[model samples]
Target: MKTALRTTTKTGTFAQALEDFKQITKVGLAVSVVFSSVAGYFLGAETIDYKVLLLLMIGGYFMVGASNAYNQIIERDLDALMKRTMNRPVPSGRMSVNTAFIIATVCAVLGIVILYMVNPKTAMFGAISIFLYTSVYTPLKTKTPLSVFVGAFPGAIPFMLGWVAATNTFGIEPGTLFMIQFFWQFPHFWAIGWLLYDDYKKAGYYMLPTGKKDSATALQVIMYTIWMIIVSVFPVTGLTGRLHLSVTGAVIVALLGVGMLYFAIRLYHEKDNAAARKLMLASVAYITFVQIVYVADKFIGGY
Candidate 1:
């Protein structure tokens, strides 16, 4: 019995550590760092610096990780109330609040240091992203539907973070990238809001525009999705100068936008869990592929 109990304790400890890591490094945060790094590469800075790129990724990771850690700490009780999040480390009692706090603080310091080393502007933005995400948006989620909007500010920073990392300056290129991601987030998050409406409600999260999974919210999803596609194609117009998309690349991007549109329209018409799920999947694919195409266009010259 003693040996069996010891084994069980060891297993539990390992699982807790893993869960803590996931809560700190959310998949969305990792994806943002990757896409933004690629965007920085494509922005065609006067000179490419792989060292800066490495720092951007490392710094981005810590900023995101810290924010997520703090979020879990703040929402521990609420997270336990939600089925989808009940298994989270803090809420499940797998990890203590004090441990999470220390980890978050350390990660934030490391991230800021790396970003500052890369460029002061990038560091400033990284700090701002963490502040907005942890202080403003996390708490606002339970209070107002506008939390989504506030959250989008930090959520959209990764794309721009890359640009600042590369150029050490904010310009039209980063602005355009920011706009594209900013618009895309509404539809993407709303679809998630729709799918997780029940789970979110259990935890007092007001994710949707109406805080209800109805036609009203679905319509908003469609509207923002349309806007997302439009802004994504804006670069092709050459209106943004340094961020211009060639004709061929623009056409390819448009086609990808149409694919996202199809999913958005389906969600609008169907409003079912399956449709929402599909839209969520498509939105993830859309943003990731769109960024990839944008970067590839610059290098491959588009087919």
Candidate 2:
């Protein structure tokens, strides 16, 4: 009976630790980051390499996970103040700061090594991404609204990092990909900020540019959505280096942008959580659809 009970207790502890790790790493967000990097890899590679793709996906996920872990450690105190964040591992005492730090260190080291196995530039960018998120973006949240802008830099890197990994060079193609994801973050993150404005303010995180849910902030979201729409359609013009799209794919992407813009406009009109929630969901759909459309367009058009 004692042995059986000990085994059961161990299993439960391990399972609980796994759950804590998931929360700390923000698994869903990390997966989305991996997908964006994979999309960029596909766009840039002349001949797709499964091994490199696998490394990029794994390295990217772990690097992003490490960044999240560090962010949680740094913001544990502030996180405890926010209802939405209070349940996170470090804030809730489910995990210790040292425990989380070890995980972050292991993940960062392993992730960078794996990416380095791919290319030096890939590893360099991966390290930079972790530094930006943990050092720059994490602390700046309570200090200034421009934190979102700073956060966007690292957030935008995954997409371009894929291209650099595949091509081993930095140029217009990756530049355009970087710009697309860069502009996309404003509307995407602002919509999320609008939805969680109260929770964020509870933690003193003024993510919205205007520092409140006012007309100016909503207007900024709408304007960025507009620019996101424009930049997304650029590949179809045969102007964005090796990334070209067929007319049909362009139409589909444009239609997807319109869907996102509709929500952005509605958010501007309502300027409420409900509209912001809808816009947040729409932004996710817009970016995923646009990326899928780009990859599919290439596959079909033999580009």
Best-matching candidate per TM-score: 2
Which candidate leads the pack in lDDT?
Answer: 2
Candidate 1 structure quality by residue, lDDT tens digits, 102-158: 988998999999999988998999999999999999999999999999999998888
Clashing pairs in 1: none
Q: Count the backbone clashes (under 3 Å) in each candidate.
A: 0, 0
For model 2, what is the alpha-carbon lDDT of residue 61?
A: 88
**Worst lDDT 10-window in candidate 2:** 236-245
Model 2 / residue 168 / CA error / Å: 0.8
Q: On residues 1-303, what C-alpha lDDT tens digit does candidate 2 reach at each position?
A: 999999999999999999998999899999999999999998889998999999999999899999999999999999999999999999999898999999999999989999998899999999999999999999899999999999999999998999999999988888888888999999999999999999999889999999999989999998998898888888888888898888999899889988998999898889999999999998898888888888888888999
C-alpha RMSD between model 1 and the true structure: 2.5
Q: What do the candidate models score in CA lDDT, each in turn? A: 0.84, 0.92
TM-score of 2: 0.98
